[model samples]
Target chain A: MTLEAGTTLPTQTFVVRRADLVRYAGASGDLNPIHWSDRVAMAVGLPGVIAHGMYTLALAARAVATWTDDAEVLELGAKFTAPVVVPDDDTGVSVEVAGEVASVEDGRATLRLTVTSEGQKVLGMPKAVVRA
Target chain B: MPVDASLVGRTYPPTRPYPVSEAKVRELAATTGADWDGGPVPPTFPILLAFEAMNAFLEAEGVELARIVHGDQKFRYERPLRVGDVLTAALTVASVRSIGGNDVIGTTSEVRDADGALVCATSATLVHRGGAA
Candidate 1:
């Protein structure tokens, strides 16, 4: 993929359900109850069961891989600005990831990503640097 | 409870070595709806090691996992992680501050290979919610 400055990559949407959170907890070893148990999440002042921050970030990484054909990721980072509440339903919620090539220099492409769920931005300053 | 300010700059011991296997890589990828074709592991794959270090730190400090929420995370890679790489993460408390009765703790973990070569540097911010006043 030829990434140039100002190029917008295709947007990707991921459906996050309660089952996915359980799978992620096992896979990543997070096991934070807020990510699975609605009772614990509510006790901690969360609206309901929330997705793991790393899981949401992983969706962004998936978008990067799709855009770059799994290019060598030199850097990836993001701030968890808001909680993505995953309801206990089959359909779940949709998290959308969109990116634009901020710059490309020295064989690297810097991407600025916007991740959103429930029409609210979920990640702050999500960005990735990949070997082009 | 707020994290102790004195904890800043304190580095914890390196975590146990984690062997990167293809099954592990595939498992993480599947969570994100991706299929691992045995190429470079996903960019955020090192979080498994970092999270383990954080868990150890929290356990030692008597912090409850249910009271904490993730605030931020960042990863800078020296090279792509591949299968068969055994890695460990050494964590350091970077900063601590209180905001609106919540303790925001900052930590940075260095992910190193078996040779102790830095493979990635990952930083995370954890927000510990205070009990009712």
Candidate 2:
């Protein structure tokens, strides 16, 4: 697919709840308490059970992968700016992801991702380079 | 607990070769909500290997894993990795600095194939909170 500079990709939304976090913990091998145990999270001075930063990263990556249609050949990066505090409610939090084609250079397109949760930006300076 | 400046630039030994499995990939995809579109392994899958190396680095340096928070992450792939590729990863402490009573550690882990060809590299910033008080 040909990507033009200044192209804005379709925005995607991902829902992350407690069960999803548990599954991700098992899959990713990151059994951090802050991601699962509210008591531990509180002890550690966190608001509550927060999703793993990597989990959030994974969500953003899915959007990029879906956009590029070739998740296999891409370089993705993100900065964890703010925590996505996941309350223990049945309805978890939703992360909205939108991307812009920052540039198309040398057969590679760099996408800048804006990831937000609860009306606040959760990731900063997120970027992905896809060989299209 | 500051990451000793001397630890910077130190590369650990290559990890045990891990053969990526399709079943594992499917499990990861199901859990992470990734579409099982039968493409290359997810770009974030290297974390399995990177985290292993990271635990080794922390243990060798006497850093408590419980006190650390992941600050950021990035992955650069020479090419996409696929299932059945036997891979190994070598980790290096790329940089380290302290800010506001916390230690920020920068790490880069090189994932290589059985033939030592580069596959993907993962870089992460770990923040070690200074104290409990």
Candidate 3:
């Protein structure tokens, strides 16, 4: 089925954990203490160590991919708005997605996405172009 | 102990070709909660291949991975990558400088296809924390 422009895809909700942050730090060659150590993070300028912006955006892309059954993601762009604080509580960090198909034709779809936390948009202008 | 300035402007030999795959792309897409439209590959996918190139460079330079930080990354693409494409990525030390007892290293990578056609250019800033003591 061809996705028409303005068609809203399924929303995805997930959390970020200290373990996942550490693993991403290793895999991506990013080891800033602010990403893994809450004490260090608080010592710096954050409430606590937060997930990498790319990591969070990566999950957002998964939302679009799952909707279309693993179609090719042509391009994606995002900007980090706020730190995803990893609290001591095991609840971790929650990410919610609200997006719609911006355009679609010939097995291709462009999605405009917004990611929020507690009514505040943390990731603004989330966009992706994909093809199946 | 700053990163060797002599490495600047030096272009390393291209690393072994890495093949792009559908399954890998799907995995990345799954991780991002993205929907693929069956079009071109995601822009960030090549970073997976580039990471290998970066690792080889670090190994050759004797740089410790634990001490490095990815300060920034930017990708400029001419076209999308497709599955089954055998691509080569060559890393070059573009610039370097010392900052507050640390070393900031800049690197550029050019990715090309088996036919030697340029596909994309990536620039990254690596902060060598505490290397310039």
Checking candidate 2 for backbone clashes, the offending pairs are: none
Give the candidates in order of lDDT, highest first. 1, 2, 3
Give lDDT for model 1: 0.94
Residues A13-96, model 2: lDDT tens digits: 998899999999898888777888899887767788888888888888888878887634468888898989988888999999
Better of 2 and 3 by lDDT: 2
Candidate 1 residues A1-132, lDDT tens each?
789999999889999999999999999999999999999999889999999999999999999998998899999999999999999999999999999999999999999999999899999999999998
Native-referenced DockQ of model 2: 0.73
Off by over 4 Å in 3: A1-14, A19-53, A57-89, A95-132, B35-39, B131-133
Write the residue-wise lDDT of candidate 3 on B7-126 in tens digits. Answer: 899888897987877766665554444445555565676676566677777778887654565555555565778888899999999988998866788888888999999887776677
lDDT of 1 by residue, B18-130 (tens): 99999999999999878788877998999999999999999889899999899999999999998999999999999999999899999999999999999999999999999
Q: What's the lDDT for residue B8 in model 2?
A: 91
Top model number, TM-score: 1
How far is B4's C-alpha from truth in model 1 (Å)?
A: 0.9
Kindly report which residue stretches of model 2 are placed more than 4 angstroms away from their true locations once superposed. Answer: none
What would the TM-score be for candidate 1 when compared with the true structure?
0.98
- Residue A45, model 2: Cα distance from true site in angstroms: 1.8
For each candidate in the order shown, give its overall lDDT on alpha carbons: 0.94, 0.85, 0.71
